[model samples]
Target chain A: MLNIIACFKWVVDEADVKIDAKSRALLMERVGYKISDYDRNAIEEAVRLQEQHGGNVVAATVGPSTAKQCLKDALSRGPERADFINDPSFVDLEPEQTAAILATAIKAKEEYDLIICGEGSSDLYAQQVGPALAERLGIPCATCVNKLTLAESKKEIIAERKLDDGMEVVSMPLPALVTVLPDINTPRIPTLKQVLGAAKKPVDNITLNDLGQTYKPCLQTTGILAATMERRRLKFGADEKNILVIIGALLKEGVIA
Target chain B: MNFNLTEEQELVRAGVREFCQKYVEPLAEKVDEEAYFPMETVKKLTEQEWTGIPYPAEYGGAGADYLTYIIVVEELSRACATTGFTLECHTSLASYPLYKFGTEEQKQKYLVPLCKGEMLGSFALTEPGAGTDAGAASTTAVLDGDEYVLNGSKMFISNSPVAGVFIIIAMTDKSKGTKGLSAFIVPGGTPGLKVGEHLNKMGIRGSVTAEVVMKDCRIPKENLLGNEGQGFKIAMMTLDGGRIGIAAQALGIAQAALDESIQYSKERVQFGKPISSFQAIQWMIANMATDVQAARFLTYHAAWCYDQGLPYSKEAAMAKLFASETAARQTNRAIQIHGGIGFIKGHKVERLYRDAKITEIYEGTSEVMRMVISGNLLR
Candidate 1:
């Protein structure tokens, strides 16, 4: 049976995101989390391929200790098992650093014929990580893939990658990486039975130290500018005479220009 | 309990807001003015499988909880009330009947597509003289052996012109009063089933409300919804969530107007200072903000109740009554703030002012909502 390993993230569930109005920061207090929507897409693709060609699919995510829900959600959706890199230190990893840590986890396994990942996480949506992790792993990777095929005779997979300008189909040997589009297939929801069963299923918990890096940090950012651009406002007066002044002001500001 | 939204809801807000602003708002006014239905938008949403929110995925719908559906509807309406209304009534008024009562085969054939948004759907309940009192429907469906011959007219029904199929309520046993009413799925262009001219409306014009005339509309007995005598109850139950949609619709219109007004206040100068600096304008904006937020919480709370499978009729009615009226007040203030400019035909606030009032009238009027709320309290 083919073995597929899907890389995923425990992100603030887009469905439950709460933005702090005051600081313009993402809220995290009892703020619910879930497997990133894109990563779920990637994992679902792996599950589909496994069902198609007889394989075992293991889903994995790197997030804080509270990210068990991400692994649980993934496991409930047909992955044989899951990996959650748990630690508070992981609370603020940049995209590149995250890719490195995930690559280390994948390398530690030293197994699996294929690796799949979401095109992007819903939280950041930077469209990084997947390809970056592939680079770190020294494996061939394709992003925005719509089709995945396993050629039994050739012992390889042929995949179709959609690009902004055009499309390309590439053949990757075993131990390859593929990032899938959101439209690839609707991610199946975990039922109550699956939710209960996830507790029994194994979710291998790893930490940042498990990656064997003594010192920490890479690609540090200066800081985030909250509300990068303030929206321009133009109001009209309460009375009819002021309406002309407002219109004239709007016209002068080139708002109506 | 903190009634504020959690993290996932925020993400939903951002994404849905982006979608609505980019897709819906730009075309909203034209849709309302021209009565042009968005077949493309419907097709796009169905393809993305967004048509069915809160319905179980097993039935080919999103299976999101009711709260999630409300959030989406509110966001969609914030961008374009018409788009939200289409999905709201389509699912709540038309498809809910099937999900509540249809057999397995019926669900597979009709419920599946309706939830999938693969086809436009509607509830044919309100006739010319029989809107709030749907039991007064003059439309008659007589049992004609294998097929039921339906001959009645439903007026002011949204999505009629473009609806692929309709969930029609007809009097099968008129002598039995409301108990004798039966519902059916009448496919569009079924020889005698036709959509009448679109009604020109004050706002949310993108949603086409027209008369659905059944001139000997024929359908197999298999298409009968629920038991032979349960249409009115089904109709009432269907509007439970449908009312919430209108409330959210009110919230959306109010939210848009308030957003515009606040932004405008910050920029427009008065007494050699930004109008936002004035206490009076700030007070108006503050009240508008609080009212919109309160209405949102009420609507969302009712939606959450539905998700928990609890009784939410009273909460739903309360939300509808408060939100719609609040929205009208806010929109009226929005126009007042903008003065003569807001009174223009094209300004967002003017459109909002017009749009806000409909929420009070449709699904259930404020008085009707009060009755529903007060009536539920008695029960």
Candidate 2:
């Protein structure tokens, strides 16, 4: 493989994401962003491939200035380097738009043999970005790939893609797009040593203007909407009141035994 | 008497079993063959916060009880006895005393690091002369001004050679007899304290077990654990918990051996049929299965009682007694069933047979367990 560019995302921390009480929007204030869980899967897969086939695994993300942390985490994982398209407007881009921005940035200075992205983001779970990005770049795309075995001689791969029923095994040419499932490979934790190394690794910070791509929204929200909180129905224990109420309900329904 | 695990308990078992099956099983042989402590494996465990499992979460532990701790130990032991032995030393011996008796400041200083897997801890209650009778310990931490000058050596101590901290017991008030003893928190690299060469062991060979030599080692007076005359009681109380862990360890090795024997029985052909089809083979497997189940029941019941805060000292010793001895029989039977294959160096049953012998020896001997349990009842 020549180069593998993995698509990453910086979102509100999955653990801390909350909803705004009034607006019903995901409360993002002070909820520091991180790379989407699946995106880490992509980065690990790319790194694994790089280790096997000898190439560079570059991490690319389109997010706000704070999104740089996602690239930092990705580099900490196993990527050769990272590129970030930092713009306030990049925060709300849909799969296609995010892919478009990343594609432009990836194509600007370097040519890649393969483009790898996660099957989907945990927050949105859209399952669209990889194919759409590949279409935009005009390369063959494979999604939900569970296994990747390279044929170094042929410069191709035998991939097993996860399907609804089971798994579909296929082979693809070198210059392709692959969206990986989380099971493709377990992501390695950054050792304290690796974390320190990541702090020093150079990450390229590129603007939307630098990639010759402007803000373009593929999907837009009407307004900031909070999550509709669902209340759990409570069940009473074997207290006297609960027993009496159960007996009353049983008599009403004519099924007391 | 409850046979079913609660939901949280079930989750604990499943999570631990899954982690061990996926991560530990593949590299277990290499770990044993190489005598490696496996930094990568410990790093993975640190991610799950498995190092300090039985203590409260405030102390950097997983906040689980004895049952949950055994679940982790049993699963890890199933694949790799080395890791299980290491965890047992940390949780059941070194750090547990601090959790039960140490002051808040002491816990913060010693317990947190060990429980978080940030630092490995060791227990030094055993001396060459004091193998079974902790009261016979010759190591003395004589009070001198603001410090206690510790002199004497500890032998067959687990995790000592590589440990960051050691919880040691020594005579503080010699005239008071056993009551004269006290425990101390000896930080590694304290001047005059030396970790001797690692002891070569027959089983659980991957985990480091060595001698600790203390030559006029001085520790602050604050290092005393509990009261000045409580060392013997503390060491014995800690062993009550430690016995449960040894039971879990024995069960793990026996289960692995049984599983291996079953597979071999099905695959190995004898007298024109799979050995599994033979009545003698069937009988041996039957005995192993029943014994292993019996051991598990005893171990889990002991753990359950401990979790419920009941008087589990009798139950724990019973569990340790039955499980360790039963594992020895089960592993021996497994090896016999495999015949020549089981005697080979690389065979799983061979390793199990070797591993099974140690469980009966460590954490107090099987004979020692009977004495303790009987002594408790007589009291």
Q: DockQ: which candidate is best?
A: 1
- Alpha-carbon shift of residue B85 in model 1 (angstroms): 0.7
List, residue by residue over B1-379, the lDDT tens digit for candidate 2. Answer: 4587653454455456657877887777777776767668777887777788878778988676778789778878888888888889888999889999999999999999988899888999888998887788889998899999999999998988878999999998778878988989999999989998877778877888889999999999999899999999899899999999999999999899889889899999978889999999999899889999999999999999998889888899999999899878988998898898789887777777777788998878988999988999898
Give the TM-score (0 to 1) of chain B in model 2. 0.97
* Total residue pair clashes for candidate 2: 4
Top of the candidates by TM-score: 1
lDDT of 1 by residue, B1-379 (tens): 7776644444445446656666677787776667667767666556545677767877777766677667777877777778888878887887788888889999889888888777878888888989888778888988899999999788898888888888999999989889989888888779888788888887877788898888887899898888888998888888887888788888888898899998888888978999889999989999999999899889988888888789988989999999999989999999888888899887788888877888989887888898997787787
Predicted complex 2: CAPRI docking category: incorrect
**Model 2, residue pairs in steric clash:** A24-A225, A24-A226, A25-A225, A25-A226
User: Interface root-mean-square deviation for each candidate?
Assistant: 8.3, 10.7
DockQ score for model 2: 0.02
Judged by DockQ cut-offs, the docking class of candidate 1 is incorrect
What TM-score does the first chain of candidate 1 have? 0.81
lDDT of 1 at A235: 67
How do the residues A185-251 of candidate 2 rate in per-residue lDDT, one tens digit apiece? 8876553234434656778889867877475565558776755746435465798889987777667
